[model samples]
Target: MDASSATAGRTGRATDAASRRRPLIDLADRRALLACRPDDAEVTEAGRRLKEAALLDFGIKESVVAAWLYAKCHYQIPTTAVETAAVVAGGDGTCLLLYNPGFFTEIGLGGVRFVLFHEARHLIHRHLYAEPELRADPVFTLAAEVAINHVATQRLGQGLPTREVPDGRGGVTTERVGIDPREIHRSYRADLREQGLEPLGYDDFVLTDLTIYGELRRMRNPPVPPPQLCVHLAPDGEGPALDDETVGRVVEDALTETMRAALRSGGLARDEMLGLADRSESGGERLGRMWGRLGLAALRGETQKTRRVEWWKRWLSDTLASKLREGERLVYPKKQGAVLLALGHEPMLSRRGPERTKVVVVALDTSGSMPDRVVDWLTTLVGRTDGVESHWLSFDGAVMPFVPGERVAGGGGTNFGHVVDYVEGRLEVDGKRFEETADAVIMVTDGYAPAVTPQRPDRWIWLITDGGDDWPERHDPPMACHRVTTGDS
Candidate 1:
């Protein structure tokens, strides 16, 4: 041989030797792999080479490669004796032979090569790493089919022919490719055979179906409905009547199983999954037991007992309690009366509004930065009070007064000083008819604005939120500001 030919021959032999020394059934040197004696030395040699090449090409480690091969040889291959053969003459040229001896013609290495290439595509796609079978198998097959066809077209100059077949009549025809879809499917099986890999028939089909169905279904079906969100109330009455937090939790739980399954199938990574946990302890029960912590259920006694007390106190007291004797009726009214009655005292009205009328003003940021949770909670709280006169105002560049029963939704840029100025301009010794100027001014925001001292000397409460571009300066505090971090606050 010439010098170049000698060097190429050495490289080929080295490659083959590397391929052969590697074990097919990795089984972690486990007992299962140790027990599978080769049918002969040639069987052992073939098994080793195939496993090595498969592991190297698929990018799976040898240990994993062995586990699968051991299972195939000891458990599956014996029952199906005919195996794929190959003839390698160096220069990356290897002929794949596929035959079962009894039912099918002995297919040339071209068919085998095509199938292996297709399966090789799946390995690169890394679909098998999921556990609990979260990933569909057909996804792999479909990916392989498309990839192999491309490869066949590129390397062999063999474009899959789109022939027009006669369709029951002389005049009409149907367009079909010369290659069968099943034959394309058979490629992956052949690829696995050449590599000493054999999964259970059911498992193979499952994976194949997952890939194929994903593609074909994509072609046939309309886009899947955006993941449905069914809102459920949290158990402790802390969250809104219907909330996203509850839905988010359910989605997290659903994906947890999928995450675990993906880890087992072989090539999947964990971080690709998103939103599997709460951003904050915002929704669900106060005690966090709703949905049994996975975000789903209700407590029977807790819900019913609380409802029963509220029912008689708020709804039934006037009709039912009037006829009863003083000590007989369970009439709980007013703030003190509510606390006392719950402590088993006779019902009374101590919790009722003070002898003087009370006025409360809510200065809400209609800024685009306010989260949906903040707006919903504020709306709920403002709606719940019965006796107090309430003023709701939202501002950005200017303060827009929102009277009770008027709908004021959140959305706009924030300018806190302007809002403060408006509050100042509107307030005087004699203002719009009211029993008292707002005793308390509650401001809800993500703290995104220029800091300003409020004109009114009322007590101020701030609802601070997550993620905004700006923050109020601590040196410029509003009147007696109290901070609340989440919706429950």
Candidate 2:
């Protein structure tokens, strides 16, 4: 019997692991078949060689390993009677069978390889297990599908036979027997949706990979100072032709927007021109009009275009100067010591007995790698308040009590989970849930820690990092973040 038929009756996990040990066909039979020109006896051999070459060229030789493992690990049944399909499995563990010989022929060997790789990629990403987030993860799904398809196209073209199959034979004889790329793309999206992944639109085909590569690069060598502003410039604009002058304006504009919204308002107004200082923020169109007036005013100052109408340069310099001044102040009111007095005056807290006052556990990640500014702000936030008792735990790899008002322990390896476990224990002992037990748990670190999950937090704030570590698939807590600058220390 042929190798495909030899294991036809097998099914389930019992044989799954064992099947991974050998080639798709017995060795002797494979060699004899590959040693010949395309013929009836060599059709399966041709298919095997095409699959092998496809796997090697595509950088997914493990796909074959995966296929063997999957086959050995699950049930397999003969589908020779079916005419136009290969394999289909939904994330829910339900699977479909097809007897389409065109699966091998019509799409060509490369296409089959890509199909397998595409499905395996989904499994590796654990998309099948996370239905709710499948749509959200279309980036991974679509990029993976493209990669698989590229591989399949390359391999099947070079390896699979182009000869016609005899009419009575069990092969697809039609010229256009392969799955349509459009249909395949649609099916790919549908599968992603069924598994809870948001299907990425065609636009995301380019966008998703761009974001992924960017993120991966960042993860390897984390960004230095936290990002002060995130600006997504439209790519279509011929805006100033991207010279140094244009780049400067873009950066300046981005900073101006960030500072105007995030930083406290106090700066030199454009010109001595008295304009209405409305309490309500104006639209960008109004702002643009104002900007134009300011530029015309500057131009009116000096007729020379170089001096009077350097709109971008003047706008950048002034905006940057203002933001630089505001950057000296922490963006959050609570972190600046202003919230303590307000909290003390709140009616509910004031009316409650002193005995019911909440406890605040502020754990600081005093790792060797943590920046000094983090320790200072951490100490300040935890120490600034009264009306409620606060405990400080300073940890590197394990927890220990630290002096309430001092910056004593820090500069060691950080373990974020230790803080979580410590807080969870404290909440348990206090007979209170996280929300009630403490007003907040403020963690200060660079976010260089193993995966950690805390008990439900009424308020948990991350003060150390702009970014890092998104993993373990789930169990992520909703986090409030404050980007800290390294210069603040």
What digit string (tens of lDDT, one per residue) describes model 1 on residues 389-484?
467777765566776456666556777776555555543322443234454556666676767666544345554544443233244442332233
Off by over 4 Å in 2: 1-356, 368-374, 404-412, 426-436, 466-475
lDDT of 2 by residue, 378-416 (tens): 445335433445677777876766675465655557777
Best by lDDT: 2
TM-score of each: 0.26, 0.28
Global CA lDDT computed for model 2? 0.37
Provide the overall lDDT of each model, using Cα atoms, as 2-decimal numbers: 0.35, 0.37
Error at 61, model 1, angstroms: 49
Segments of candidate 1 deviating more than 4 angstroms: 1-353, 369-373, 379-383, 403-412, 425-436, 455-458, 469-473, 476-489
| Collision count of model 1 | 31
User: Evaluated with TM-score, which candidate comes out highest?
Assistant: 2
Q: What TM-score does prediction 2 earn?
A: 0.28
